[model samples]
Target: MYTSDPTPTSTLLDAAQTAARLPYPLLVSELALVLADPAVQVPPRLVQPLPGGARLLIMPALDANTAITKLITFTPANAARGLATIHGDVVVFDVATGQRKLILDGPTVTARRTAAVSLLAAQRLAPNTRGPLLIVGAGVQGKAHLDAFAEGLSIKEVVIASRSAASAHALVTHAQSLGLQARVVTNADEALAGCPLVVTCTPASGVVLSTLPRSDAFIAAVGAFTPQMVELGPELCRYVADNGTLVVDTVDAEHEAGDLLQAGLDVTRLASLADVIRADAFVVNGPVLFKSCGWAGWDLAAARTALAVLPH
Candidate 1:
């Protein structure tokens, strides 16, 4: 029997540092490769509802030699207590021996990998776009996306929109601290007006945008995973269906993304991120929508990347 010592643990800060060391393009390419492999297994995520509207999520992925599982919890009410809504850990193991290798901070890996994948789609679908990037939501994903874009893409300015003015302003301050020009917008419509790239990371149960986005924009909606919650409305879906293809991280999106479910989108017509990367072309010459509901394969990829950079 194969045996191993106890696994090393990495914190959120360590995960962030490790993720930062890797280039966005490389991360995107790695994800594309993983998704394209026929041998890689990404089963549907398991969900268990807890009391008080909280839920636990179990996501697992496996390749030939590596396996990983992420255990996360979503507590919407945590925000009232000034805590993060999502929290958990990712466990990585050796597939051949079933030996645990490493444990990583789940939220950090999720944020970084999610943002990186979004940027990947944006790069391919809207390569010529120059910002003024618009980011909706002032939470963890919001800040992480800001940092990713700042480091990976060229942008002249940034606009942040949130339900609360204080949250938006605080994110603006955070952006300035990073030496990026950013400001707060009063509403989503104002923020989406002329921005070439838009990212939504809120947790609103209903449609968050009050107005239609520009026809030439590339929108990345990362919030609203469950079928009952949505960030984008039917109008946006219709627009994309009419002009450009609606892109998703995986085929599982049809079952997990509330934005797509609420819009009654045709899953048969939606394009996967792997297909986009492989084709290296946009499905249309108009606005594109990329909706991601978190994938376990991403957690696996991120864990491998983080472990490579961490000291032994």
Candidate 2:
């Protein structure tokens, strides 16, 4: 059977082009559908250690009609070298004919999809949707999350904090460019109580969020994926588990989620993003903490959406 192809020549989309194809709203829609699809298969990601404290990641996922693999290298030291920390490409293929269909910039897909996942969790779990959103970490993921919340949630105000003044102000400028009232704070913890919707995207080796959020707060901790890295304080994580709902993006998080793992949380007992979405009746009691570990299924879903936006 001939497969319908979106990129006959395997057209390669750069960062900007790929970002253009997968807007937050479209990516969120696709994520909700793909996450609930029983036919989708996401294999565990392979993390191989490279020399000099670098890592090579191999992620693959597929569905009835499409297949994708994202190969990327992660080096924490890249920051010291004044270079990007993550770099790679997402290659898309057709299932029926086993032919290459398209290629997308890997880092773009990673940043956008990661932020989109957090946005999805916020949409379902956040107690307050209106007012100022607090964002920690002023990197690529921080920018992507800002755009997602601003565009998808129609959030009109933002407060940003980062280790670097230049980076934080730059993100503040970006937020205002989107017509959102934006400012910078010196401390994320100090800014937490005022903003009920919060996203932590730092790559901290220790707990970045120690303060307990307000009862109406919704927190998406997307910073630390490895057991060696953690962004949520142990006490705060335990508080959420006892007093509120603790959610994860995928089951893989049980082993990979540094925030929950370091927080001494029972990762296996917590509900997931899919679980909340499928629940017939859901109610929020206290703060909601959504921990996200990387998953290839998200990349596969993003590939489908990115391809659909491409001309046949």
TM-score to native of every candidate shown: 0.91, 0.96
Worst 10 residues of 2 by lDDT: 1-10
Q: Which predicted model would earn the best TM-score?
A: 2
Q: Considering summed lDDT, which 10 consecutive residues are worst modelled in model 1? A: 1-10
Clashes of each: 0, 0
Tell me which residue pairs clash in candidate 1: none
What is the RMSD, in Å, between candidate 2 and the native fold over all Cα? 2.1
Against the unseen true structure, what C-alpha lDDT does each candidate score? 0.78, 0.87
Name the regions of candidate 1 deviating beyond 4 angstroms.
1-25, 280-282
In candidate 1, residue 189 scores what lDDT?
81
* Candidate no. 2 TM-score: 0.96
C-alpha RMSD for every candidate = 3.4, 2.1
List, residue by residue over 1-312, the lDDT tens digit for candidate 1.
112224544344455555564446666666776776666788889989999989899999987767889999988888778899889988878766777777777777788889988887877786346788999988889988888788778876889988768888988998898887888887778678779789999876667774676778888999978888789878887777787657888888878888888888786568888788678554556777888888898876776565455343
lDDT tens readout by residue for model 2, 128-240:
88858999898888999998998778688999988878889999999988999999999889999899999999866666679998999999998888887888888899999
